[model samples]
Target chain A: MSPDRPTLTATPHNVGVDAAVAAARRVVTALLHAGDGSAAAMAEVASRLTAVAEHLEEHAPTRDERLVDMWAGEGVTRHDPVTGPENAVAPPLPLSGLPDGSIQGTVTLGLPYQGPPGCVHGGVSALLLDHTLGVANHWAGDSGMTGTLTLRYHRPTPLFEELTVRARQVSVEGRKIRTTGEILAGDAVCVSAEGLFVNKHLPRPR
Target chain B: MSPDRPTLTATPHNVGVDAAVAAARRVVTALLHAGDGSAAAMAEVASRLTAVAEHLEEHAPTRDERLVDMWAGEGVTRHDPVTGPENAVAPPLPLSGLPDGSIQGTVTLGLPYQGPPGCVHGGVSALLLDHTLGVANHWAGDSGMTGTLTLRYHRPTPLFEELTVRARQVSVEGRKIRTTGEILAGDAVCVSAEGLFVNKHLPRPR
Candidate 1:
């Protein structure tokens, strides 16, 4: 069985579609930190979430086969969840094009992404870097799968604060694309990464 | 305000409590890849999930504020969406003590944790490493927050497969614990990581 359970493999949509996904993400975020003060509250919360799950199960595609890897084409971690629009979790990093062949993005992670008390989760830092580096490779005309990613977390990345990330392709060798980038809060560089992405050999369709 | 959303401080629970959290995580894993085949299905799923959200919101404790890092003491990341049980995302990697004072864990990533087609998200791999390294540091009696986590994705870490992770503290400075670990599928070393965990200087109780 494909690791990717069957998803509604829909193409990313317009603003209207994105907004709805964003709203769902907001709720998910809220739940991420919704602390329990009472047992009754916890049970009620679980039941409700479960009902939602049940409902999804009911309406879900009753399929014998599943669609595989539809990595959100516009996936920008801290912005979208894989479960959000086009199977992307909402609030996607709305990265924009840069004339200089690099990509820039901004996002504010919340409770859901926390690792330390007030810092964004370390793996999350790398997620942003990996995605950005992949995009960087794409812009450089070398889109591929990540063969290796190396990261350095210099300082704690704070949550609920806007962070800036920039990436550019450094060099290319055969099927490998080397790229580097950094995450910043105002002037502090919190995390930096270099990734080696390899272009997948596509099966030529007859 | 501290970026870590204010949470209700609570201690970890016992096996029974952990079992319940584990159950919740299972449901979440189902939802993560719950494919919506129709708009009506999506709405129904939304409504059910919303009921769950509403129950939590209404019964949730409205209080002054508190910050805590549960770290899956009761965390079930895949199910609880990172908030339900002790501040964790469900389908969490539950690591625990061994007689030898080392820590070991196992987990399976589904659709939501995918990156690069059939593989686990790179950042997720790093997250597991960071957590395991911290656990190892704790076992070595040198527990601390992460100072720097460096990871090398030797190859694509597969999903929905049981992956074993092991960590150990290699050395320690006055306030730093240097650790290393790997995620494996049987015999293949998919990812390797080393981290520097730093002891946080806690504020002296007045």
Candidate 2:
């Protein structure tokens, strides 16, 4: 059901080239969680942001060139939408592999990630679990593209609270890798997922 | 298959605000796609971004208050991660209702959304279709939480190109709704999804 409508007053609002990246991420969270809600204020924030963007663009290479360069080193890991430090959209979740062969991380989401009022978007839960599953496969000494993924939502994932994400490779058969993952609000599972990955080699970037 | 990494130079960089919102979205895209990549440059951008954030904070409400205010109207639609204009993380794909009870939209993503070098992240594809399916449910005069969603990645979804997303309601059984959708690169399907939604009433904000 829709919530009560309020007249929006309107207002507005990344990383360096890690701390810079973190600061930028905060910028997004702050804007979404506590923006002025006034049009004039939003315009002012936008203008300043535009100036910053223009400055960055002034020294940056083309996107195609950047894309090629990203694969050259740590770009793939550094710019991904889930954990990439260079990506502002990512909660930038930093995943660590456990000795037990699972990958895990914790992230506290905010208004920018909301869906059903005060809760994390259902799709976002899938995104976190999917990415964590990929990392689990990597930890298990395998890399593959996701072939199929299935998810179940157990409960609403509240916003502005730390949620734990965990995943593990369940089995590997030839080129097939099966993994399971979950997003937890404390000890309660909010969403759980299962994935099948195919280990076929993808073309490398030139 | 990684690409070559050119060392990131550091760099740095929203809206009332509708215009402000668009500008802010551009800031995120520009930073992800064309950032200078140097620590120094990034630090400078971060500093500027922090200043803007602090300034916005000066006039903003608290996160809890904003959360309440959001459901009070456009906030729900305007702040969601997939379609919320206020959310920079969203590619913010806009969906339209079709004559035959379906929903559709088109968007072009770039580096911020990449998973496999030049391709759109698999999870991101799931995010898109899930949101589109929700919209489709709304169009069909039914609303429900996503009970189960199954996605099959038929092929890699390429980034930086216009991709079409479409979903339709298949059937309704008692309080259950079944829907199917896909992400397409031109005419070719990249990822297809089936979702089961339960028509349970969720609590609303006061």
Candidate 3:
């Protein structure tokens, strides 16, 4: 007889994954409807995609009951709902699929993340850069917490648009990883960032 | 013979030495009033200080304009205001005299910096760490833009109370500064931070 199995907790305890997916779908759809397809619009889209990713992280399974492994084993690759854009900005592929030294992702933004009247919050922009640069460090095989991130906002990132972010490892010395990236609305870069991420020397899971 | 006097432009430009001084005064005053001399209070105070700093940066001067030699010769330190609690926290300094390489400040909280009803925003806590660490870095003579700030929030930093942030420089490299700091409510450390700040290699003034 099998030993008493630990009860499994269902995901989506917060607003329910379906609700989050629906909200994200609504935002993406609105962006598609606007159809400006400008670089600014793309950056906005990237922001929205980040929110969806955040929601998924909030609802996903936890590892070890203490920390949620944000970059661990992935379950969903992409979710294309009916309300999503016809050519909806595809969800970012998992880091697991990427080559050992590269990181890339796309996202969309909407109203909920707005800080200024119609622009993304500066803090939110910093968050995006931190996560993206962190991923770059991880891809370069140097996993660490963010030590510092410097953002230069060349232009105000507009809301409700699709954006692309690409992070590339610059160099690594001991426990510190240096990387740089930019958030592109389309071809226009709205925000650029460079960072130093320091590996904390935590034990890797077996 | 009289020396030819340069006529001053009177078009109400935003970037000027007087404007910077005014902005600094406003920021310093807001920071002083915002703190209630407690760790939790410092969280809220840091948020208000960030808003004030951002406003000052936005209106008072551009980074390039700030780099002008005339201003540099004036013996003014164009310190960037604390942006947020994640990477920096500047608590209100009560006493005029403190030893070099020390972090000293107090603050109070209000509804304006609230994240969830009565609690201070998590990001606000991070902002506090950033500012406090930056100050520590400044004291250590390794002043630079925050390259990375890491914050571990052990508990919810509360809202509306006197709080203190004590920080000190740990070590320094050629261009990298290392510092450790904590936000305390009486005896308990609410949040702790370790930061790496890269020195700004400004060109020598002509």
Say which candidate scores most in TM-score. 2
Q: Estimate each model's TM-score.
A: 0.77, 0.89, 0.37
State the lDDT of candidate 1 residue by residue for B35-108, as single tens digits. 43333345444455445555545544432232432332443222222223433343456665566666677778
TM-score order, best first, reads 2, 1, 3
| TM-score of chain A, predicted model 1, versus the true chain A, to 2 decimals | 0.76
Considering summed lDDT, which 10 consecutive residues are worst modelled in model 2 chain A? A5-14
**By TM-score, how accurate is candidate 3?**
0.37
Across A1-206, the per-residue lDDT of candidate 2 in tens digits comes to 11222111111112235555566666777677654464237767778878877877676777667766667753236677888766778886777766677777788987777878688898988888888898788778886999999999999898889999989999999999999999999999999999999997566576
Estimate, for each residue in A1-206, the C-alpha lDDT of model 3 and write its tens digit: 11232111112222222233333333322232222211223343333333333333343333232112311243321111101111011122122214445555566665323333345544455555655665566556676655555666566676667777777889989887788888788899887877776766333223
Model 3 RMSD in Å is 16.9
Task: Give the per-residue lDDT of model 1 (tens digit) for A92-177.
Answer: 55455476777676778776566665577676677677777876776677878777777776777887789998888999898878
Give one digit per residue, the lDDT tens place, for model 2 in B1-206. Answer: 11232111111112255555566666677777664453237667778887877776666776667766767753236677887766778777877766667777788987778888789989999998888898788778786999999999999999878999999999999999999999999999999999999998566676
- Whose DockQ is higher: candidate 1's or candidate 3's? 1
* Candidate No. with top lDDT: 2
Point out where model 3 deviates above 4 Å. Answer: A1-100, A201-206, B1-206
Q: What is the number of residue pairs that collide in model 1?
A: 24
